[model samples]
Target: MTASDRIWQAQLRAHWAVLSARRDTAGVATSGLGILVGDEAEILAGVDARGDHHLLVPAGGGALVVEDSQAAYIRIQRCVLTIGGRGRTFVDIVCHRADLSELFDDVISSMLTELATDSREQPAVVCKRVLDEWRELLRRRGGLLGEDALRGLFGELVVLERILAASDTYDLSVWHGPDREPHDFRLLGGDLEVKTLGMAGSMVRVHGIEQLEPPDKGDLHLIVVRLVADHDGLALPDLVERIRPKTNDRRAFAAALARAGYSETDAEHYRDRRFMIAQVAALPIGDDFPRIAPSSLVDTLPDEVSALSYNLDLSLLLPKALTDAAITPLFTKGTLS
Candidate 1:
């Protein structure tokens, strides 16, 4: 576990201790331990009349917790937990089994860490995602991403940073690559497909026919980011942390990062994986561009060929590259589609 994780665990235990002490002394029917987890979100650790331990996470924006969202380790529901005569709605998570309290602490620690990460998502959304991720982790352990995946994610973050810099209204949901969308970013004016290559590499891999296909009504542009590993350059974690503050919705951005298979827990793994940009080329996909799209292959190809993957040599497409000034306009012109 990281130092941050340890601190969160200690804080949770301290809060629980105070609540437990109160439960024993006054014999109160219920007690709450409310404390700030992040800049805006507050957490409440409580002891019920039956001595059941509960953790209440503020459910921002009136987000609801569904009925009986329980697992073997914890029970979850929505309720208004009060302390010091102040009431606030929260997603209440209960650990009835004493033997599972340690496990519960770990879970709460993870949730607090996520909440504290400058997330802009609703508190309920962040809590549920953390719980879901934990459930997946326990079901089958997963390892850190490979070098190629890391580079791809790094390139996407670079572009996202550019987009954020170019516009004031940041909507992280438009970044659909992590969700396995056909395009990496869906902007109002067009859709963008980002490809990351080695500094010396020439070929750009086209994953599917839909990849280069234009949006239903807008244009499509392919962004090629060529990078080289350098000791002086920034690592994945550096870029992530740098961009986190610029985004208005940090939680949503964090969730997008998580979906892309990047996590703070695995930051140590990418410490040495620093990258320097070699070049960034923006090429608008049009009729003249070389690509295999469903529209281009209409009625001519065999039905048996359901999928396609190929490489395009970037050296052959120099004339198509857009200038740096032109690149920013593509992201800035469109509202999030």
Candidate 2:
């Protein structure tokens, strides 16, 4: 088969594997969340080809290898990845671990926020102010408000943008949407979710800010995020759920089964698939306000990453900086299911 065929097959298989996992995990922990798992979770021991014990190492050029167990193994492309793991806990080694990276990123960000010429005019402060204000106001206008008109008014691909926009504290500082490649978004360089909830007069809550993922990009997946409310008195998750996918695509799996040549009757045995995001950010908008990187999201990144890659993803939460001063309006609301 050709590479494209291989990708298609892999995609099908990946969907199958994910659906299988989702049947049980309740979405908190899964293969894609970067948690390197094995077929034998309860009982398995031994290392890979290397003398070091089996464990999750930073497989890619820039992931956190959460060396959880010597018996755990990481993979690449599709198969299990072979790598060297020194003595220590597996979680500590990987770059994807959030606690370490996020704390570090936050400290650095706080320092930078303080060092800026002045707080109000500083890019970071401006970003926080804008994001906080917008999210806050929306939280106030409680009770099933219309999302379409609200989002367009606040400016976002999802109605959530307007829900957040009502915040006096948070404004849509940056609204990033997903692009063709680089399938996901993260806080700073971390891949998870970053978003706000709340309304004016109360306070805004930001989440997925310090969440962790396995750093794994294929097959099994895990999605994690944090949620904060601006003030009090509103079911945020309920409102947000109105938009997220009900579940992973199960038909995608049946198709895979059929492709593998299974009988239609057997194919129907597969459970429906599911997907979820802790939070979503907006795409890059022009930089009227300074677009500071949420580097504070990570603590100990791999030895390799540079400062430049953090605010790079054209996310729906974060805006892209434009060179031209003129602002041209464009359609930026709703989601692609």
Candidate 3:
């Protein structure tokens, strides 16, 4: 743990002592930092009362418990963060005793900073945002990829390499964020979504119907990266480290990594795996590309069929594939600018 963590832990201990001393009373105990810790979870009101920004974490739950998904941790009755008050004057962001990981410390520190600096947003809202961010970060670290970690990491690397090669302004921030983003990388002129396959597979999974659908005015291209497991190939950490120096803002790059679910704690696992890019194919989302857009299927499908997903065989898309020479220019600087 860092010095900051030690200080925060000390403060928490002091706060808990005060709370225990005043257990019989129903009032707020103001800390040296001016943070009010109420006796209960429902009545916290030192900050904004909008309720959207408020977060209540439980206190004294042994040790910090980090989990794979936000739902799993947040939804449980154990030390969890929740919005809205049940009539108590305080909501505690519980610090678990099992694992006081750096991530939790950072989260607590961030919430306190936000509370101290920004009075416009409700505390609940601030807490919610912080929890959500951490949850997403944890998801990226291990949840989303699950068993397909190598393939997913390779896909992201392919996109990152292309972006770095194409633009001097390339940053990891552009490559990772909310997975719901329509494309993998958002550039000046258009967006690029990258798909990767382990073997010489002809099919690629289209996550959602909107994945292949381009923005109304800009360009959207799909890049298929075929990879083969190579013992001597580059590890995920090596690729990340190599690109880290190229980023304009290191803080943003780190935030982007957290947002994408990549954590330093799990870096060792990825370093053990290696892969080499074998083939690259690029296809522009045009009239000729094989895809199903909601606009096109809205009238044909049943009204009840709101969400749909399917796979497309690349063998069928061979005729539309951009030649290697043609695809190279797409990654060149100013191609999107």
Using TM-score, rank the candidates from best to worst.
1, 3, 2
lDDT of 3: 0.56
Worst 10 residues of 3 by lDDT: 45-54
List, residue by residue over 159-187, the lDDT tens digit for candidate 3.
67666766675555567324558677776
Q: Is candidate 1 or candidate 2 better by TM-score?
A: 1
Candidate 2 residue 7 Cα shift, in angstroms, is 29
Candidate 1 per-residue lDDT over residues 49-117, each given as its tens digit: 666777777665566666346574476788875556776677887777665565577677777677667
| TM-scores of the models, in the order given | 0.61, 0.18, 0.55
- Report model 1's TM-score to 2 decimal places: 0.61
Model 2 deviation from native, Cα RMSD in Å:
23.6
Q: What is the C-alpha lDDT of each candidate?
A: 0.74, 0.25, 0.56
> Which residue window of length 10 is worst by lDDT in model 2?
323-332
Kindly indicate the candidate among 1 and 2 with the higher lDDT. Answer: 1
Candidate achieving the largest lDDT: 1
Off by over 4 Å in 3: 1-144, 176-178, 298-303, 323-325, 332-337
Best candidate according to TM-score = 1
